[model samples]
Target: MGGGRSRAALVAKARESIAEGSKSFTVASWLFDKSTRERAHLLYAWCRRCDDIADGQEYGFRDGARDLKLDQASAKDRVEAIRILTHRALDGQPTADLAFDALGLVAAECGITREMCDDVIDGFALDADGWRPRSEGDLMRYCYHVAGAVGVMMAKVMGVPSDATETLDRACDLGLAFQLNNIARDIWDDDAAGRCYIPEEWLVEMDIPPGQLMKPAYREQLVQLAGRLVSIAQVHDMRARVGAGRLKFRQRWAVLSAANIYGAIGKKVHARGEAAWDHRVRIGFLAKMGHIASALKETMRGSYPPQLEPKWTRGQLMAAARMAGPVAGVPNTPLRDEGVRRKED
Candidate 1:
């Protein structure tokens, strides 16, 4: 198989990866047109693959246990492997991993820069090194590196103009909000894994010792902190809606549906208080269907109320991207030879 045949297989694989890796996203993605939906799946495959590799998990399976031991040397080697594979993929070279090839296809089609992918990889690097945030700003910056960067890439995949900085920043805000929700909901799980995303300063403020978050005595204090985290996520989620308004009808509906699904998770966490971690918070299928229906209504209404001004700026986010490395000078060129010989890193 070659040309269209090969491309179709890659896309099918990517779609399968998304379906198995993230059911919620797979459900929300149905709102996208076929082309955008395929590209989104392709991009998500690369992101998911990178995350799985970094955490030592099997691709497409969240049940795999991660090694809690931090081996800095081994972690650095993995990061290097990700960098080499990603660079080759962006250069239109074949890679051993189909997910990386999908990345190349999406990067070529959507003009995704090396800087954007690097920012995401950097997040994995942080996790591999067992980094812990010391302050709220640090946590937010980590979120930007991981999820916000992915959101920016997704915005590009959605066909947002590269120069549309405001819309792009809002896209980043949405990713940050989604991550905040994850952090709030996964506090116990992360703690069990010897990782903590909650800021050390916040823990100190609550008089809770670092790495002792699950102590029964601090349950109420932790619940209060989770509520605050969800509140912040809500603010950014609303701002993200402002950006969604700028997308096409189908894209807008898809983005809004995703927001509602993830935002609902955070709200449920907040409502459940400390009990949020008693069981992993999940949005049921019926609720997700309802969110999609509501999103469709919002799309038809075609107007979102004004959002509060965001504290984070496009410059700040872009500056972080630049810090990852100089922006690749690759032109937004059309896809070249799709039959490039595969390269192993």
Candidate 2:
């Protein structure tokens, strides 16, 4: 098949692969619209494929096959996919890799830098390394590279002005919050695979070994820590909502819908605590549809709330934002245990 034919097949395949037509709330909410739907599918496929390559190496492959397991082929595929869409976008041809193609087109059309994409890929690459993060900040840095960069990319794609610096900053904050939720949600699964992304320092300071968390003895402390993480994530959730007001109508609604859905998950986590391990919490289908309707309502009004205060203090926001790089000079508060355990940067 030619490129056009292949692209069509790819889109159809993606929709079939992602039942309910989305992998997450970010895409799931707006996917009813054709344009956004296709783009969301393609973006999900692209990001999912990249993540799978890095993660696939850990599941019972022979020792010798590890290198091949983590080969650069998936990354190459993403690049080629983007290249085709980028060309079509430049030529003013409607492209097939909708989400990613839109991503490329928007980035190019708006002059958004490509460094953010590179950073996302770099963070995914770190997954191939058999290392546990030593601090919550380290974990956030990883989250920023893999997820926060995507938030920046999406903002640029939406054509948000550089002068809307405050909004852009909050968008970045939302990404980290969402990723932290993922970490809290997937702790059991990640630990089972010998991949503990939770900060080792925090665990140590709690007088807990990550392995022992599996025991019932540490259940209360685990619950408390998990609750705290959820609270921290709420700060970003608020930032995201406030930031959404600064976007154009359509994009503003998109961000709000997404933030609402994901932010709801954090609430579920806090309520359920260790129960998150038993089953991942998801907003009910009705709740999701409701969120979409709410976004549309706000979009039609053309008026987003202005002058909303940030839920987090300036100091807290800075700590979350600096997760993208080495963290130094940041205050460390005491956890359940009294002693301090600072990891070397």
Which number leads on lDDT? 1
lDDT of 2 by residue, 1-345 (tens): 112334566666556545533445545435335554554445555455445444553222335544433344564454445445445544546665434443444344455554555566656545544445676655656666767666765666565676777767777777877877777776766666556666777778778875776567877777776776676676666667667777666667777777767777777877886676788677887887787778677656644333334333323433444443322224332222212222233
**Candidate No. with top TM-score:** 1
* Span of 10 residues, lowest total lDDT, candidate 2: 334-343
lDDT of 1: 0.82
CA-RMSD of model 1: 9.8
- Backbone N/Cα/C clashes per model: 0, 2
- Lowest lDDT 10-residue stretch of candidate 1: 328-337
| True-structure RMSD for candidate 2 | 8.1
* lDDT of candidates 1 onward, in order: 0.82, 0.58
Q: Over the stretch 20-47, how does candidate 1's per-residue lDDT look in tens digits?
A: 8998999999899999999999999999
